[model samples]
Target chain A: AQRVTQPEKLLSVFKGAPVELKCNYSYSGSPELFWYVQYSRQRLQLLLRHISRESIKGFTADLNKGETSFHLKKPFAQEEDSAMYYCASFDNNDMRFGAGTRLTVKP
Target chain B: GAGVSQSPSNKVTEKGKDVELRCDPISGHTALYWYRQRLGQGLEFLIYFQGNSAPDKSGLPSDRFSAERTGESVSTLTIQRTQQEDSAVYLCASSFPPGPQQFFGPGTRLTVL
Candidate 1:
């Protein structure tokens, strides 16, 4: 069975500080990883995908097959970046999301 | 221009009753998915529809949960004899193909008492 693990339930950081949301997965074959963010009163939207290897909103994630981890990172956090972040992966033709990490960037 | 949309943003129902939640996927999207999120838990995959393939019910928790999609457009999830544990936010998402990136809906918050 494919499983995704996000250890942090909540993370707090000051503005301008670097942020990293940890994520790990267990799958038999190659997996596709994605990071989705949901702001207050907004729908969940895709932030980035490992396959694309492109940063969105200044966030990037690299898939490490050996460690089975794909962590999302940002050079500097912003107040507006505060939101619920979910790490997900494709499994059995469907996507599975993590428990989610609520990030709070204090000004 | 519209993203995925779900009807009845909020619903409150009594136990032992049934509820049907509807979802309208983005036009031209060939894949639709249904997920449930508990109060403070991760999203649970309930069902999925891709093109004309048979719906995948592998993630469904029990036989009480069933879902149907009409030709890759609109989808509806029905829960019979709802229980307190069934109370959660039901989210709908659509993607261009089978799976890659998905666009999510506002979700239907179902509360059972």
Candidate 2:
């Protein structure tokens, strides 16, 4: 069975501190991984995709096929970056999402 | 120029009653999807409409749930004899065919008493 796992339900970090939100997946085929974020009172939006290999809002995610991980990382956490983040994978006709991780950046 | 839209932003219904939720996909988008998110839970894929055909219905929880899309535009998801388990936020999304990025609409929060 294809599955996406987000091990942390809530991650708290101090402002200016580095943060990482871990995501791992189990799939038999080549995986297309994406990171989605939902800010308070805002609709969910795409953050980035592994294929693009681009960073948004100073955040980046590296997809490591060897470890089956696509962990999102930010060199320095910002207060405005606090939000709910989800990792997702698309396999053929089905799209699987991991339970989101709530990141709280404290000032 | 509007994005995907969903009707009845909030719906409160008594258990055993039927309800219908509507979704209007972005114009010219050939792929539409519906998902259910219970409180604090990950999104659960309900159904998908690619053009006028649904190639996958395996994610729908049960027969109590049904959906239809006409002219590859508006779609409706109806639940018969709604149950407490049916209470969730129903999210609608649309994108171009074979596109990996999907735009989401403000979800409909359904409450079943």
Candidate 3:
């Protein structure tokens, strides 16, 4: 089974506009969810994890078990926020990632 | 003090040739993992190593791909009889045991012709 799912391949939002990146997982157990970001020519780094429940760079994600979704949302997008975002789930000592969403926040 | 580092940042090999990629995890991190990402694709879990425990090799795609970690430190992923489809960026990440927060390397871009 595909452990993680990201429906959108690319998302574009204007500065100051709201943006949401959808992510869903198929792991049956309480797998840890994480959001990772990679800027151009940079190594992939952890943006935030569901376990922390803390917002980083104005981005927050809620784990909705009923829907099995952990959608990342930000009220106002910034150009610096533009990068590649990947949703990942860790289970059974393995981390599975989605196809990723290339977020472009235009000015 | 150094982050995860992968050697041979980029490699280009001919088809059917074997290639070895190396990774050096952070000190004191007993957990090491190898992953890869093809162009326009997501991260693909390749293998996981923790402490002295047996590695979880189930994620390996085939017998052609294998990895080894010595004394819970550096690791190397070897691919035998590489094919064009094997062209991708191989990434390495490491963290403390049972920690979900992994520090990733810059990744090695392998191009098989």
Candidate 4:
């Protein structure tokens, strides 16, 4: 069974501080990872995918094959960055999501 | 140009009743997916449909839950004898074939009393 794990339910950080949302996965084969975000009153949207290796909204995630992790990172957190972040893994035509982490960037 | 859309943004029903939720994928999208999100939990994959092929219903929680898609257009998820635990925001997403990215709908909020 494939699984995505996001250990933090809630994470708070002051503006301009670095932010890291932890995500780990369990899979036997090569995995396709993604970071999805949902802002206040906004529909869920794709932030980025490992295959793209591109950053959106100043956030980037690197798939660490050795650690089996794909943690999303940002150098400087912005107040608008506050939102719910979900880490997901795609395998065998199915996508599995983590419990999600609520990120709050205080100004 | 429109994104995925779901009907009956909100539905409230009594326990043991049946309810149907609808989703219309983006035009020309060949892959459609259904997911369930509890109040404070992540999205749980319920099912996926590709073109006119048979859908992957492996993620469905129980036998009481079933879904159907008309060709590659609208899809309906039906829940029989709904329970309180069945309450959640059911989301629908669609993607093009060979594309990993999925576009999501606003979701339907289902409540069972």
The DockQ for candidate 3, computed on C-alphas, is 0.80
The TM-score, computed over Cα atoms with residue i paired to residue i, of candidate 1 is: 0.97
Q: List the residue pairs that clash in candidate 3.
A: none
Report the number of the highest-DockQ candidate.
1
How far out, in Å, is residue B55 in model 4? Answer: 0.5
lDDT of 3: 0.93
Ranked candidates, highest DockQ first? 1, 3, 2, 4
Over the stretch A1-107, how does candidate 4's per-residue lDDT look in tens digits? 99999999999999999999999999999879999999998889999999989989999999999999999999999999999999999977979999999999998
| Residue-wise C-alpha lDDT for candidate 2, range B30-82, written one tens digit per residue | 98899999998998989888975644677889999999999778989999999
Worst ten-residue run, lDDT, model 3 chain B? B94-103
Docking class of 1: high
Share of native interface contacts recovered by each model: 0.92, 0.61, 0.78, 0.67
Pick by DockQ: 1 or 2, better one: 1
How would you encode candidate 1's per-residue C-alpha lDDT over B5-86 as one tens digit per residue?
9988999999999999999999999999999999889999998899899988888999999999989789999999999999
Instruction: Give the poorly placed runs of model 1, Cα more than 4 Å off.
Output: none
Interface RMSD of each: 0.9, 1.3, 1.1, 1.4
TM-score of chain B of each: 0.97, 0.95, 0.97, 0.96
lDDT (10s digit) by residue, model 3, range A14-54? 99999999999997789999999999999999999999999
Where is model 2 chain B poorest over a 10-residue stretch in terms of lDDT?
A: B51-60
